[model samples]
Target chain A: MNPVRTTLVWAVLVVAIAVPIAAAAVSPLLAWRSPAYIAAGFAGIIAMALLLVQPLLIGGYLPGLPAPRGRRIHRVIGAVLVIAVAIHVAGLWITSPPDVIDALLFASPTPFSDWGVIAMWAVTGAAVLAAFRRRFRMRVRTWRHAHTSLAAIVVVCSVVHALLIEGTMETLSKVALCTLVVLAAIKVGVDLRVWAVRR
Target chain B: MSVDLFTRRTLLVAGGAIAATWGGGLHVPAQAQGLAPTPSMRGGSNNYIPNAPIVERIGGGGFWMTGTVRRAGDGAPLAGQRIQIWAHTTEGYESDPHSHGATLTDENGEFRLEMPQIVPAFGQPHGHLAYDSDGFETVFLRPVMPSSKDTSLRADFVLRPV
Candidate 1:
């Protein structure tokens, strides 16, 4: 890609991710919320934004940043994503244990909890599988297939989870980000075709 | 004539009893259902708990707190405003930390939150709301519900800038 086009692509991606976080910071809700809740809320926004990046990075969809460099950033983002989930749950736990317990136990009346928990487990499972691939005696092709399946689950469930929520996020920006994430996820799935790892 | 008068008085007493028994079914004025002359209370939220759990909904989600938050003078809808609500309910008292939760307004400056049916306490069924965001001068409200059977209550706030 030409330098101008490359810069445009990167800039659009950054702004798409940053807009939601920026909206939350100026939210009057921030004044009423506890520190833990605010931290958790922002962490969730960051994690969702990072979701859009992960697929693009791994699939080499980014213009300037190619696979090798993108992959390194992807690894660091994975760690951050995990920490974000931990903080999200922890903040919720502090505020109300029974509610979080119901969500974890799959008994919460809310549908959003189920989606979030499913996405969360899928992400965690993929991370663990990656960490212990050698011990599990998994070949490269097998690991790739397994990881790809989990990635697909994470993207779909996370999108539903975010869309179902009626919280502090501005609706227009939230929908835009979600739509972009879904399109990006689909692009990677079709382009990379990680399922056909049998070379 | 005396027998006819006695019969008329007996019927009147019976009709009065039935009306009293089913008062809620009567055509009570809709305008009479809310707190009369609701004003910002003096030290109303002295019982407000810090960090009282910001949540999307509270308890079993049967009752709702919904209203518009707007600027005081301009009456412009204030999107993204925060309103913290609590009441004595099946779960706990208004002062109980568990009973408290906060929610943010949407793009149109409207806010709604689900909570358990508020039970009457100290002879009044009421819900406490506070415009406790820093950008506005604090305004607290204690709105009286006309009946405990009410599933929803509305409390519109016009907050003055701090």
Candidate 2:
């Protein structure tokens, strides 16, 4: 499929997934028990897992991709992950508005809220720094350093948020997401260590 | 609800006079002085701690609200209020590249919400509520979205007339 077309398709799919979740706002009964939410949450976790690795996946750190193909794949995965996270966040919001607010504002008075809020801020900062890297005349090394740091923060916080929350994930999905978070973090750490040693 | 036409006329005339004077940069508008701080919503990340648990207070207003919502009657809990909230962050607007949104309420009338926690102290995050046949419009109660958390804080809105 054409990349642009594929992007459009995924965007719509995300909205389609988000609407019901938002509409379910009127009734919790319409939420929590729905399979759509479960599917979306797990799917989002998987896509986000890919998103976390996108820099390396695109930078040819992975074995299979030629430089150009790696770059293209990374971009595709990043876009897909954005859509996935949206569905994930939206679904959670529909289930519990107050709790969602708690997470976003770090006001839930729950420890998980702190982690979630921190992850959100880190993700935002990373995106901004990456976008303006060229304009700011940042050294490629510095940009890479900043990007990697922020990405790590995002992954760590998101994993914590997902793990602590009792809703949606349940036993199996929770285990799967946690596993992905750990594996991704470990791989990133190993890659960083190797890069440092080579330097 | 008696309308005092004489007072109303004088007030209207004063308001027009003030507008005309302000247009020419003459006198400062009287309306500007006594304006109370209206509650505003914000989204993004912040750290807000309220000073009082009895009075509904949100600390630091930007993209998020970190205050407590409580009941006015006997301080009992108000469990099910459908709240729809959205806001922007540094990365995008609510429901956009830099935003987050949610719909939820407390199970026992006391809920804690965290949306995008922005820190502008005056702007309220845009929010909607479903009163659930309680004769309250979605807009009846003042909604605030603070960007940080307040430990043991409560912001109460009285639904019935005092």
Candidate 3:
């Protein structure tokens, strides 16, 4: 990459990650909240930000990273995403068990809760599929198709889920981050022709 | 190898377009629009025992919130557990005068708190409570809203051992 282009890429990446965080930091709600709640809310936001990075990594669009290295980092970040979701849900459960139970049972009156639960389960399904990929002994094309389809579900549902929730996350920044995540995933999915891969 | 139809330049342009469209349509914060606050926004998981002195009170009036903190599975009462309570009232957030209070569980793991008479605002007249103890997992209760004409509320907590 040219030096100017490389610098621009880094700058864009930094801004994409930093903007949402800065917005959340300045949230009016943060001033009156407990530390545990703050940590939980930020964990969810950080998880959303990581969604953007995951697609970039898969596409090898991040500067200085080789394709293989990016894939490895992608897997590592996938695990981090799982942990982040765990913290987010666990925090919510501790704060309100009935609500979490309602969400899990698909009975929560809040539309955002339903979307969040669906996205959480979809992400977990993708992770489990990835872990068991070898044992399945599937053809390469079949595996890619399945994986990419799950990725699509993870991306779309997570974005919708985050956007629907009007909580700790600042509105404009959250929407911006979510849009970027969807765009990145779509770009990578398109570039890779994940849907068309065949044995 | 899979065929790539989107070149780097095209992908970048698409991303930029998405960013521009999204950035141009920003709106005010969601809370201002009457959306319910998530547990984290209200305050994170209530896991740690508050260090302040615990007030023990027994009263019933406009609304009295009472509960027992017990161990999950075993159903043992967690005595001496610290519980923090707060709520948004018609007056203001919990930080405003007479909107927040804390107490400790008695030997039987029972706690009682007196809530301010709050007219519904933002959402409903509700009380927020958090239970914390040395060895039990932290438990946070949602803002409890009065269901009927009852002036007393019971919001029990069952915490797992960590």
What TM-score describes the B chain of model 3?
A: 0.57
Task: Name the weakest run of 10 consecutive residues (lDDT summed) in model 1 chain B.
Answer: B29-38
lDDT of 1 by residue, A1-199 (tens): 8889899889999899989888878865455446776777777788889889999998887996699998888888888888888898888666445546767887754568889899999999978886787899988778888988998898889888888765556768888998888898888878887765454
Model 3 misplaced regions, further than 4 Å = A197-199, B1-162
For model 1, residues B7-86, the per-residue Cα lDDT tens digits are 76788898888878678566344423432333585334635775555797997789998888877655667898888898
TM-score of chain B of 1: 0.73
lDDT tens digits, residues A1-199, model 3? 8889889988998898899999889876565455665777888888898989998998999889867999999999999999999998887665556557767887754566777888898889878877888999999778888878887888888888887665666778888888899999989989988876356
DockQ of each: 0.03, 0.02, 0.03
Model 1 misplaced stretches (Cα beyond 4 Å): A197-199, B1-162
True contacts kept of each: 0.00, 0.00, 0.00
Give the alpha-carbon lDDT of every model.
Answer: 0.77, 0.48, 0.70
lDDT of 2 by residue, B1-162 (tens): 987876977999999998887775742343333322223223222222111122121223233332323343344344554433333332323333213233234665554544333321112222322222343322222244332232222233323212
> How accurate locally is residue B12 in candidate 1, as Cα lDDT from 0 to 100?
88
Q: Quality of candidate 3's docking, in CAPRI categories?
A: incorrect
